[model samples]
Target: MRRLAVLGGVSIALVAAAACAVSEDVSSPPHEEPEQSIPDADVREVAVGSDAPAPTRGLLCSSDGWCETLLPDPDLVVRDIWPFSDRAFAIAESFTSGIKVLEWTSTDSTWRYIDDNSQNEALAELAVGIWAPSADEVYYAVSPGTIYRGTRPVAPATAWSWSSERLPDNNPANVNHGDATQRRLTLGVWGTGSDDVYAWYSNTIFHRKSEGGGAPAWVPELIADDFDAPDEHIFITGAAGKSPNDVWFAGSRRRGTKEPCDVLVRKTPEGYRRIADGVVPELYSDPCTAREGIPQVVGGPRAWPRKFQSLDGERFFALKSWNNFLRIEPDGDGYSVNIANVPKTLLDAPNLISLWGESEDRLWLGSTFFNSNRGVVVRGSQVWGDGGVYEYSSIALNGAPSNGPPNQIRGTSNTNLWAVGDRYALHKTTP
Candidate 1:
């Protein structure tokens, strides 16, 4: 099933449901930075209506920006791509039904499923998220249910065995709250190693440490114990860290009679503590009044900053709805959060599906245009991969054909990127 869309974009239809709209003065700003260059050659006209030429549904392009179809059958919809090593492990759904795992082979330039119909069903199950610390060490979580770990020999060999464990039906986590398929009880899974796996379910986080057993035997532990009480109501969305102790979890809460707010929490050997609240503020605001407002959960599912990832050992990045980009870095014992200035065109887009980066300087953001199949790519860069200052520009997309913006993006480098979504699979091989 497709992962539920995170609420970061401002949809035209959701304007009425907005918490409160107060137009703020857009005159002065906190700090001014150099604006980045836009790749106008890559930007194309929005293909609209039935008369437009059919989009190249499964496209894979090179570093130079030349693209070609990756899948022979246009009916196969690529959902997610986990580019690990020289190979890419992805979840693709065929027209007939079922989300299957597809392994892209660099050797022969082809794609194949991990498990054919006759093999183990555990390998056949669709996963909500995929992560590969290494080619031999890969992990994926099937929402509302289990987490599977797959170890492989290398590419071209599609055969592999997996170890699966059922997620505990613990307290406070309501996996069965909404739609069982689209909105999985489990949001995502990640780890630095097999024994140190972490899974997020609703507002709770579960940890499975290697228990001296062979082949990654995992015993689940309710690691996130210090969540906000029932009064505030916490919802855990995105999580990532360099290690188990050096991790960060992004969540939001609506306190009694108070506005909803998002907070970033960091965990260490000492324990977890609230690092920052109202982390990403509106760009056009008084620095003094920036933290004065709250970020009410707008469109749906937990919202944007709900998703985050570490760009390197020192820096982390996140997104907030209605066009707020965040940059986080280690500052002594805590973290310093900076509100980034995304391209205005991208900020006005309707929906944001995914955010990922190959490095601190080469960041990618995916968003859907208002009422159009076209998605926008905002490639951002900082001053020499270090944080605190940056600039961004949008690359308009063509040939999406109403499938929605690209949902997930992953790459080994900027030139070796892949953006997969509802009905489209785009690849960038060259610079």
Candidate 2:
């Protein structure tokens, strides 16, 4: 059930290859000792990661080079994606047809089926996550909790402004682990619009605020009050920021020896701190805490951190434990992590699921290797002398023989990318 994917626009090609060096010594004197600012040439590139080699077969590509499989029923499985501004929204499944929510705007580039009420099968088996923040604000998340808020239709025979409520289970109890008990999973949804939204159940942190500006409500944000104890259990996997007080939330805290460290936090206006705790001890060792390796999965989130932030939230990243990428920054009164390097290591998989871009030199990475069912699509580059590094170059989009396992990836640039899993869906457009 590891499907997750998001936003849109186009034209993105940021390849920063800076090499500047200016020095003046006109004999020497102005204070006499000032000449040691040399730090360049580090074009960051150490990624043949997870051992990239064979690929280029029929060359699967989207973004116009033609890579189509938008469901003509190849057994359907394009779980999540939410591009904007030419519109896109996806969540599809098919065992005999069950979960569906599809759309493509700007007058249909192809892909339809969007009938609401979350297709109700008890809220499509407690929805889980899908966020859109624009193109008429969309959101859906249901579980032993809820939150639905659509608003599309402005034409094409208009009429869609649904809404549902109930969300505040403040850790509604679950976590025993002697014989097992941790099922409360619902772990995503970000914000920056629709009155600053946010949602995260399982380490609780809900908040919405549109106020005198009107409509947008969901509360339960008392962030980090000792973040749950009695043997630990914090879980918030991913969040971004721009407002709602400059945010950032990436998770992991499990302990009681069920092990699962690394949990970074940061939310301002003076609340919630702790930038790095376990900071990723290779994700608590033993190749993701022993037991045949990775998949400590209980109710939700056993996925090792997948993140990316920078839209005025001031840079932060974490592809951690699929073989490290952690970045963090802004150190002067707090924060500084850095641990890059993600290249070749598939069968040794440790989960590096999804991450998007718009910055960090046009980032985007998505991985999955459930023991060689394989999946990868890395293309990140952020190189600038000492203290500015991140370089990855991967391929092997599971579609080797033909498609599946990209999990989720979104784009608004970097050639307007988009990726899906299992039954396939791809679109890269150009560059």
Candidate 3:
């Protein structure tokens, strides 16, 4: 749907309905620091390293003879890209019909897939991770009602040698939180650590430490032991693949009462814990009043800091401004955040810019902290590799033709970087 056409309630209901299962809240040790001691998180990032060349994959391409090939028409739509092993990498592709696992030779840039007809369905939204513990990747195929771990490679899919009982199909919007294909599906997903796996499912959150194989074995735990009780509800929002325990979600309800309306968090071994105490006051004020009051207070939980990610699966960070949180310098010695302080003429929501990164360095990208109206793009520092901040229209597969005022950084990783919703909605960096 176009950004202008998305209805807050309807969109939420459409997605929330199918995802109406899971649960949580987060709690932080109170700091003795003064109220003003908390500093903004946007630090102007500097180019840490150089464009340090990417290992060239010499794979030649067969042209579709359609669009401008020179303009960068790498056929395989890359849903997600990350180091598969020390030398190889994998990109998940969910095209028109089925899903595919493209393993890159990194050296030859020539990547192939385990093409099995049954393997074809919908790959996780390109940006979403296609769990590959070893070489065989693991993913849930909702349309076919199966969860595939990686099959024999043939043409365009993993053609996994096996399949399993499908995950419950409670997704309302048919989207995958990982990529456009499953953005709204709200499939069970989580990270235990760079190597562990996590899944926040109905009433329970499952955790496991394993290399991709057959069924996912996990230690069962309650995301919300009392979610059945009135006032408690959990909905996961942002998560990390590097660390499954670093999962984050939103919920509503007071701890002692069933008032049921609050944001929460749940980590490995941790139960559903409240993350926020109260909604920003500006949310209750009239828009007319809010425009003058503060943009940070207008939206609801939508207004409350909606996305969260692990700062390495241990400490967590949030992009909490409602208007437009601009110019982030994660590596900056002191700079943390820069609110709509950017000149408004070139920007839109000073707070809604998209946020994603792999390391505070390259391997990630963040939306423009300034000029969001025109759209902004910030590259990770060279520390990881390519680092520099640039501005580009936040356009990608499964993305709105345009989602100006509301660009989402998604708070995953640049490698985990992907978008869903439209043909152009699902955006990925490498693939």
* Tens digits of per-residue lDDT for model 3, 1-431: 10111121211110011112234322212113223221221112111111113335432221210110110113334343334432232333434433444444334433444333333322222233344445444443222223334434455532345443333222222222233332322333434433565554323344553436654444444344333333233334444423443355433322222222334343544543333322222233322111111111122223323344445543343444433222222222211222221224434444443444455433233333454433333333432112223334344213322222223333233333433211112323332
Estimate the TM-score for candidate 1: 0.67
Q: Which candidate comes out best when scored by lDDT?
A: 2
lDDT of 1 by residue, 304-353 (tens): 36347886546776766545556566444333445544554435555656
Q: Using TM-score, give the best candidate's number.
A: 1
| Per-model lDDT | 0.51, 0.52, 0.33
TM-score head-to-head 1 vs 3, winner: 1
Backbone clash count for every predicted candidate, in the order shown: 7, 12, 96
Give the TM-score of each candidate: 0.67, 0.29, 0.47
Candidate 3 runs further than 4 Å off: 1-78, 84-95, 115-129, 134-147, 151-165, 169-185, 193-195, 201-204, 208-220, 223-233, 241-262, 268-308, 317-354, 358-376, 380-431
The CA lDDT at 396 in model 1 is 28
Of the two candidates 1 and 2, the one with more favorable TM-score, higher being better, is 1
Model 2 quality (TM-score)? 0.29
lDDT of 3: 0.33
Name the lDDT value of residue 131 in candidate 1: 72
Candidate 3, 279: how far from true, in Å? 7.9
Q: Using TM-score as the measure, what is the rank order of every candidate, best first?
A: 1, 3, 2
